[model samples]
Every structure is written in C-alpha cells, then in structure tokens.
Target: MTHLPLAGRRVIELGTMVAAPFATHILSQLGAEVIKVEPPTGDTTRALVRGGPSGTFIAYNHGKKSLSIALDTPEGRDVFRRLVASADIVIHNLSPSATRKLQITADDLAAVNPRLIYCHIRGYAAGPQHDDLATNPVAEASTGVMDDHRIDGRPSRLGPSYHDQFAGAYGVIRILATLLQPAPTAEERRIEIGLYETGLHVAARDLAGVQLKMQLLGRPEKEGGGEFSMPGYGAYQVNDGRWLYLLVLTDAHWQKLATALGMPEADDPALAKLRERKKQRERVEAAVRAAVGKLGFDEAAERLRAAGVGFSEVLPLERVLAAPQARQPGKLRDLDYRGLHFEAPEFPGQAECSPGLPPPELGEHTVELLRGLGFDERACAALVEQRAVAVAREGDFAWAPVRPEASGKA
Candidate 1:
C-alpha cells in the first residue's frame, strides 16, 4: 500500500474477461485506483469456469472497483464519459466492430482527458485476416502455433488461455511504457494489441521456424524429439509418476548429467562429440528422462543437481500455489470475497508489490467518486436509483456484492 508506484494513478477499465480485465488488474495491484465499468448485467466472465461463474474472473480481478452501469442508456453513457474524463488510462478488449458499435472509442474518451493512454486489446490487427472470427483456439490455430506444437500433424489446444493471457501481459507492458514517456499533448494516445498476432510472437519457436524455413538453407529437419534449444531441458517423469525438468546445456553440464546418471562416457563412439550425441537426440533424451523412472523424483532431482544439471520438481497447480514462494508476503494474496476464496499474483517487485485494496464490489466507490466530481449524496443516490451507478459494500478490500445486484434482489 505505502510503497506502490501507481498509488496516485487512476484507471478506468471498460473491458471484460481475462485480457483487458487482467491488464488493468495488474495496474490495481500496483496501487493504481482502477474503476471497473461493467454493463447492467456485469461482465460475462462472472459466469465462467466449471463449478459456476467466477473461476478466473476473480483470479485476475482482485483489486479494482466495479461500477455496474447500463452503458446502453444515455445517462449511463454520461457516467462513462465522466469516469473517463478523470482517468489516466482506459482499457478495453471488445472486438473492433463491437468497439465502434459501442461508441466507446479512443476519440470519444480522449476528448475529455487529453493525457489519456487508451489501450485497446483487439483479437486481431487490421489485415486480410483481421476480420476473421476470433477465439483462443482460432487465434492459436491461425498463428500456426498449434501446428508447431502438434505431434503426428494433429492440432491441439495450447496450455491455458495462452493467447488471452499473453495479450493481457502485452497490454500491461504497453501501458507501463506509455506512462513512462512524456504525457501526450493531445487528449489520447492509442496502444492496440492483437491476441492473434501477439500469441504467435509468444510462441517463439513458431516465429523462429518461419525464418528457419526461409533464411537458413541448411535447416535441420524437425525430429521425433522436442525443440532443440538445449539437450537436457524439459519434462521428465520419475518412477513414482512425479515429473521434473532439467536444463543443462553446456559441455560441463552434459558431463555432469551423464556422470550423475552413471552413463559412462565411452558408451558409444557418438558420445565423443556433443554434436554426434545430439544427432541421436531422441535416444539420448530417452536415456536421461527415463532415468527418473528408476531413480524416483527426489533422488533424481538431488543427484541431477549434484551433477551440475539444473533440475526442479514439477508440482501440480495446487501444490505450486502452496509453494514457499507463493506463500511469501510479497508474492501472492488470498482474497476472500464473501465466502469465495481466490488468489492473485502481487505486483512485480520492481514495480509495486506491497498489496493494495482488493477489487471493489460493483460501484463500491460511486458516492466517493461522485463526490470527488461534485455530486452530493442525494445526486449519487439518484444516479444509483436510475441504474447509472451503484455503491459497493463498505470497507471492502475489493468491490463486494459478490454478485453486484444480489442484495438488491432480496
């Protein structure tokens, strides 16, 4: 709270789901004052995930204020305009067409706040394929990452919402950099991110392969083994069904790893040269990773590191959450909204990591924000009754209705 860099900054998040919400959520974690503007029904993400709505919704939205307003209404539009007029940044991830349809464009907001940094997370950049349909799978499929990571030429889903999260992180980096620069003389500065394009960039190997096929004439054929960045790198299974990763890439490390496995140097003539050993990459990797099946997880990790191989246990998501680093005061936080338990990564250490307010319940700060803008209690209440804005619960770490309109129902 006290040490956050973005303490005095103000942000208005007019976005839904992972990418845009997460980008702004990171800002809130940095102590920035973020107001999440939702439509009357709330962000659709609130109903996502298996057990019910709100799996990742809370995961990436734990420290911002929510303002549920009917953006389709004229009064709602005015409220949004007022919110943007007072913000340092505005974030949104609606489709290009949807953005125009909503009339919440950069031009619209920046007209009020000249120094506004408007960040738009689009599913695609302008081009021949830009207007094509978009979704996580389509983004990955279009970017050819699915093809690159595929085995037997069969496509597969990339881990997690890779495109969505990558786009979220990309938006964060853009905002931070824009903030560092001289504030624009004009009202708005536009920063657009395309999930389809950015996802391909994040799939570094796929980007490398484009050049590999074009620039490098002597490109080696793709093999049965994995990517060739290093020999002793990536997942290996242990006898007890545990897994670990080893990343030993130098001559000394190779020797150390081989010795740790008691895999003698004179096993075969190919062992004489690292190049020759790499030519038999599949067999070599099989020998190394397969050793885990005999050595057990702990024994293999210990022996491997002792032999100079960089090895680490691969814990499941739950186990990883309980890891020492995750429990550290400055790394993560367990946020309890009503009875719902959620976790969020703290701000980056180099940025602002001291814990800030939890995500605000819908319109939690409506009165306060309205008062700041010259509204009296009566005016604020009038606006709330009109469904233009609503108050969040009191003393909430983040906004609190859990369901912003739930209490109103009862």
Candidate 2:
C-alpha cells in the first residue's frame, strides 16, 4: 500500500467544538498521527447532544488519539510540553485569554520544538476585539454573512457552521504550506486564522460587488437577494410534491429548459436573450411553474436530463446519505464507534489508505502514550492519581446509532 501524504506527521490538537479539531481531522484523514488534548472533563462537544459522542464531535474528531489532561495543573503542563517537543504541529482554538493562561501559545511551545508548525484559530484577528469570545454565529454576524443570507428581512445564520469549518480549512492550508517550506527556519512557524476574518473572506465577492455598484451608480444597490436574478434559476415543485432546483444560466440553457418543459410562452423571440428573459422573469417563471406543476418529478428529471439542462431533485438531509452520488467508492468511509455503524465522507483527494481508527475515547491512549514518553506503568498511575491526567474506563464509550425506521424509505 502507498503511504498517505501526511504519513509521518505528528499533530497535537488542543481544540473543542469545530475549528481546531476540524483542522486536525483533515490531517488525520491524510494519515497524520493526531493526538487530541482534551481537558479532564473532556471536550464540551463530547456532551453536545444528550447522549455520549455527539454528532458534532464524531463528525470532526474521528481518527485521532485522545489525551485528557488538566492543563491547569503543573504536571499536566509538563506532560503537554513533553508532547509538544516531539510534535510536528500544534493546533488550538482556545480563547486568547485561555491560551495565555495555559501558556501553550506559539512562543511558549516554540521554545520546546523550534521546528513546530503552530496554528491558532481565533474569533478575531489581533485587535481590540481579539480577546473577545466568538462562536460561528457571532463571527457570521460580525461579518456580513448573516445579513447577506437574511430570510424574511431578518438576518439568519447558515445551517452549517461554514465560517468555523472554513477557518479550520485555512488552518490546514497554512500548516501544510509551512510543512512544505523548503528550508528550515529559526523563526517560529506560527499561523493564525480568525473566524471573523474567514467570514469576511467568504463574503469578499459580495462585498466587492456592492462597492462596485455604489461607485458606478452613486447609490447603494437595492437588496434583492435570494440567489436568483435570472428566471428559471431557482427551485420549483413538481406534481409529485418534490422540489427540483433548476439552473438556466446561458441562453442555450434557457432555450433548452423551455423546449424540454414544452413551455409555449417561452418560445417568444423577445425572451430568447438573457436580459429580455430577466425583464419577463415573471412570465418565464410562471410558464416554468405551470409546466413543472403538470409533470411528476421523475418525468421532469428525465426531460431535463434529455435536454441537458442542469437540474436536480432537492433531497433532504436524511436522503443525502443514500444518494447515488454519495455512495460512490472513495466518497465515504464506513466508521464504527462502540459498534454503532455510520458513514462519513472521505477527505477529498486522500489516497485510499488503511481505515483510520475511530475517534478515541477520552484519554484512551494516555497510558500507552505516556509509556512511550518514558513513563512507566507506576508513574502513569501516579499521574492519574494526582488528577493531572485521565483515562477512559471500560464501558465509558457508547454510541446510539440511528434507528432504521427513522431513515424512512431511501
């Protein structure tokens, strides 16, 4: 078998919720040895749901070792420093104050491992609000993401924690770039990714568009947001009560869609051009709605496919797993946590490798890892007894699988 790109890399992850953990998760998927450092109480995400192993935790923390330690204690700090000495990378999303209090900042750990690639995920960049606590929603709101995606005239956060995930992705990008640096440097390899900054980056095109319009027209652009400026470029319900999102971008696509749906009203030459179609959006959309309303989803999909007009049935979350596209080989990996079978998407472009271990139980590898760090069994026990470290006991790990009936018919 071929080695994964990150086969020999070692990552020490000190993060909760999403950002930092997600960065390490990607590294783990690429075959990095990720040691997740959690507090003795465990990561808060462990209990995000009512039961053990919250979905949030499982989604982002699979395939890593867990080391539960009380960083507040001197012994725990010593152990962490020891781990950092041999680690290739260290990533954390702890608040600025907490980072200082714990003394795991880039400078602190750089003294132990000069070649370390350290990534710090923060709510904001270094500024007045740098120390402020921020979550995904807070960052989205601070930037214009929430406002840009407003619904019914009220700001609404996106369904997924995209800002947090993007921040994590950014962390991964910087870490990998540092690792690929041709020459070893004396200066610390420090990377900082702020959720707020990531949000702004995500909204860059929209921000630029608005500014450009203001400059050209000398007035603020009118708010007309809902993802579609052109006709036949939105969701429509069919006779079978299923939604299909249609994309009629080019004039050829518009013509194809009209012809496929047999919409006589769209045959007018005036509606052939995109600008003309936009001017008569209501009529074009009405024709589309009426035509689609007359056909079942399957028939509409067939006709659209035959015409080569882009369209897809809007499957809900539950149906997404069973989607044909998702079932393709290498798209997802079967994973089990405490015997509860589930599937998760594989990292894009990852080489096929031996299946990774499931998300580790809290301190699941503490004894083994400590022993590798030159601590004997008795010393490991002493540290545990001192409340400086924790180990997962038998039966401490459990998982509640989704009931078959809950999935409905795929």
lDDT, candidates in the order shown: 0.72, 0.85
Candidate 2 residue-wise lDDT at 236? 96
Best candidate (score: lDDT)? 2
TM-score of each: 0.85, 0.94
What is the clash count for each candidate, in the order shown?
15, 0
Q: Assess the local accuracy of residue 109 in candidate 1 as a C-alpha lDDT between 0 and 100.
A: 69
Q: Which parts of model 2 have CA positions greater than 4 angstroms off? A: 184-188, 351-353, 395-410
How much is the lDDT of residue 1 in candidate 1? 45
Window of ten residues with lowest summed lDDT in model 2: 394-403
Model 1 lDDT tens row, 1-410: 46667889999888777788888877877778888887755677764532233657767777777777777777777877887788888888887777777778878767777778898888787677765557677788887667756756788877688788778888888888878877554532788788888877876775676568667666645433353645566787888888887776666677777788777552555655667777777777777765656887778877877776777788877788777767776667767766666676766573235444555565666677777876788878888888777565444233333465565542
**Best candidate according to TM-score:** 2
Residue 153 lDDT, candidate 2, scale 0-100:
88
**Candidate 2, position 96, lDDT:** 91
The all-Cα superposition gives candidate 2 an RMSD in Å to the true structure of: 2.8
